[model samples]
Target: MKEKLYAIYFEPEDWLAFRESRRFNPGDTARTVFPSPFPFYGAIRTMLLKKYDVKLEYHQKPNLSQELLRKIGDESQPGIIKLYGPFVYSESEGKRKHYFPAPKNVYKCENSGYKTMHLFDTKIKLNCFKIGLAWIPEVEGIKEVTESYIELEELRKLQSGQSFVLCHAPNLIEEVKTGIALEESVKRTKEGMLYFLRIYRFKNGGFFMLTDSEETVKEISKIEGVFLGSKQRWCRVKVEQFGGNIFQRIDSKNVAMMLLTPAVYDGGIVPKEGKFDDAIVKAIAATKKTVVSGWDYTSGKPKPIYHAVSPGTVYYLDKFPKDDETVVKQSYYNEFGFGRFVYIPYENLKQCEGGEQNDEQSFLALC
Candidate 1:
């Protein structure tokens, strides 16, 4: 049976603390800006369980009927729920705009213009590093687009191989609070245990998520709010039918696969054997890798750590597979919305005036 898709919006009621996996100690700062998808996975499941009056027992599995178990499965397995985003959205001047991660291959120039990197493959080899195919900028002094999110229309323009400026989302204000750890026995502040914690408050918009599950949609309809991240921060929920098609099909053989969410693979950043169902990966442009770990409510322990390829990473493929669904379906944590991606035409550097390939000299210089 096909799952029903729903676009869910989360409006936060207060500041949110989406902390990283670093350990906190005295005089240490707790960074809390990176929003991982695992929290939403837990929050949605918790909301569903709460809606159905299912009590969660610590260090033990909750008693569930066969029907409920099939909908929201045990700790070891996820049933039918699948998530797709934590994308950004805001309303301005009576218009709502969606935002997504900018592709890493795109760069902003000093003159406020945008330029994309070009794919190059050479016989250059470095010690202990096998340099196969790579994406390199033709000209020097181009800056990377940092902390940038592209508007939906701008993203569409990019997917269509057109020039587009990078769009910045509303400023996220960070609030820092200093506090001392308290002793458990006496409830007194522990000496020399002061720490500063930083949290983020959105200036205008919250987050948007894509979910598909008939049972989840039915249960979520009964609830008005759910706790999002740490401190039980409340967020009002709004559900509607999602009709947007962000992925575009290109007629060219060369295709660019851009990840909408972080993906985990058994063979690290690249898929096993460097192929996506026979579509050979030619090159890749990725941001800094991140480690994903979360607290398991069922077992009262931390979930196993998985190294993930960051969102906005672009994988250049020689051709689009006949079945593109096989790419994301083979990723780890697909039920939690990891490995979501979109296809776009691969744009190459334009040719020089005399029928020579542009950036040929730059590519050779880099080699």
Candidate 2:
């Protein structure tokens, strides 16, 4: 599934139809008009542009103070100011009001002299039947992030500096939280639809699919625990596109794959349906490869290749490296007798198309 998985976070109005219209691949997907202004906004938009060839940008509400809106602009693009609040959500004569919920844990604004959500419909994206954005972040991740957490003081503080707000947010969570989710504009290819479990994050990374149809969507939606994998929904590839050891020996790989597969299987946290925390664990007793993940930001955390890798335990790279360095330095070459070459899926294993968490673990496919 990692092969078909990608999550991008983009700003309101970042959608450049002029630039993206040319890139649309017929079979990919994109989800746009996310709930908030997340840093992931740019990354999600970029990936969608490359994959679905569509623009999924966000929009902001006009009710905010000019000063406040200006501050947010440092981190975002211009938002779409509106004519009225939710009252004007639709121009249709009979459509009385937009759905409303009694506000909770509401806080009055001290900085702007207003009340909680005083500026109703004060977000970037406007609701339109033509657009349908889905919510499944918590559904796919090891943990979930929500709006309730965001609507809190802690969340407000987290989003303080990068205060990019959206207009016309879809009512998914009751409140806000520390992390905001920016959904990319989705382009449905409408082919043989299927869901995938991209094992890139598993002990031995690989991609797998569970074929389903429109009927499956309704059933899956009711699961309440599972997440919608990708809007582009694709079929899986038989070959391995990502995963494996960074510096492994020829004989050690089979051992590695065996140890890792069960860890992901046993942990049972791989979104068999979304459940968090202890649901996932390392199978140190089962894995063989020294799962080494690479980091682009910090110096990097220590790779726990030895801890959970055993015959029974599954190996998690927590970030396994997938770069030319890993392949070039760890190649199965005869010239050097000491660091003897380890054969791995070099060309095919490194190019992963998923989001930030792609290298977090080494996924293995048991099926």
Candidate 3:
């Protein structure tokens, strides 16, 4: 690390107040106690080190809390981060109607009978610290790679349970938006991204996930396997959480399935509408053709109205419309606006429109 007197900023009071309302006193309550958090973390950390050689360089124990306080004192936080502890996703009603869009941090990891809280030892036998995930950015070796680390497609496939989370960086979010992370500023001009220029999938259909760059969105009209979103745009990042996995962090089946490498591209790109459900259905119906994408306008407002690309063509609706189809004027879309559709039918079953049956039930009824 090189150093010249650069810049150092501090936030005094806000740091002290950070834990005000959200603070959990493990000592005070039996229900909220996380007695073995440190040990469990150590066990997990050890396991990761043994299996993947992943090491975390945390701030020194005694002063870590102080460091966290100073850094968070003034800096703005990430947009709409939800912590899925496991239970938060199960509760019904009251601020939980898929409280995803509200941009609030809802913890759902409490379920699975698992609970964890960050700890900062104020004074250590040999050190002083402030410890909590102050800045949990991924690190390769001791060097901090920018978001350019992972390819966007691989990350998205990881979301679909097909690929492994081998490597990812904040930059992947630009030419590629990250699955679990986003930079402070998102690049929206929609440059022709390399991931969008080409398409690939398993012909036999054992398992594979699709990913692309924004350039692919505009170019889908030209690309064969690619599907366009309602507005015909490539996806930002969409996450799918898990309930049971013997694996830690991102659960991947990389060991079982084959991998797809991304093609490299040069130059700029214009935006196109990525594929919609009709397109996906058509692709699936085609047989031997694999499509990877999320449904646009399926959720949200201004429900994306679909007609067949051609009646005979088959496509799949990855995310069908939710019960509450609301149109939101999101600048994310090319000013055309979009509908907030539901991607995971099972999760949104209660809120599915028609209430007649869930996707599975509907499919079953058909059968």
Q: Identify the candidate with maximal lDDT.
A: 1
Residue 94, candidate 1: Cα error in Å is 4.3
Tens digits of per-residue lDDT, candidate 1, 286-321, equal 767655665566764446655678888888777786
Candidate 2: regions farther than 4 A off: 1-55, 59-249, 257-367
Task: For each candidate, give its TM-score against the true structure.
Answer: 0.82, 0.15, 0.16
Show where candidate 1 strays beyond 4 Å.
1-5, 23-34, 57-60, 123-137, 174-198, 212-216, 251-253, 349-358
Residue 262's C-alpha lDDT in candidate 3? 11
- A best-first ranking of the candidates according to their lDDT comes to 1, 2, 3
Give lDDT: candidate 1, residue 21.
39
What TM value does model 2 have? 0.15
Q: Could you tell me the C-alpha RMSD of candidate 2 in Å?
A: 26.8
Query: Of models 1 and 3, which has the larger lDDT?
Result: 1
- Model 2, 1-367: lDDT tens digits are 1122111111111111100111125633321111111112222223323343333333532244465343222223422210000010111343211221111212223243212211111112222211111111111213211222122122222122223221232322112112122334655443222212111111111112121123222222222121112222221112111122222332222111111111122222121221112222111111132221111111112111111111112222212234312222222210111111112111012323756432212232211
Candidate 3 local Cα displacement, residue 220, angstroms: 9.7
Models, CA RMSD each: 4.6, 26.8, 27.4
- Encode model 3's per-residue lDDT on 1-367: one tens digit a residue: 1111111011111101000011123542211100111111122222223333333343321222343323211112211111111000111232111101110001113222111111111221211211111111111223222221223333334335442222322111112111222233885422211112121111111111111223212222222221122222221112222222211123321111111111011110000222231221111111111111221121221212111111111112223212221211111221111111212100112224674554444433543
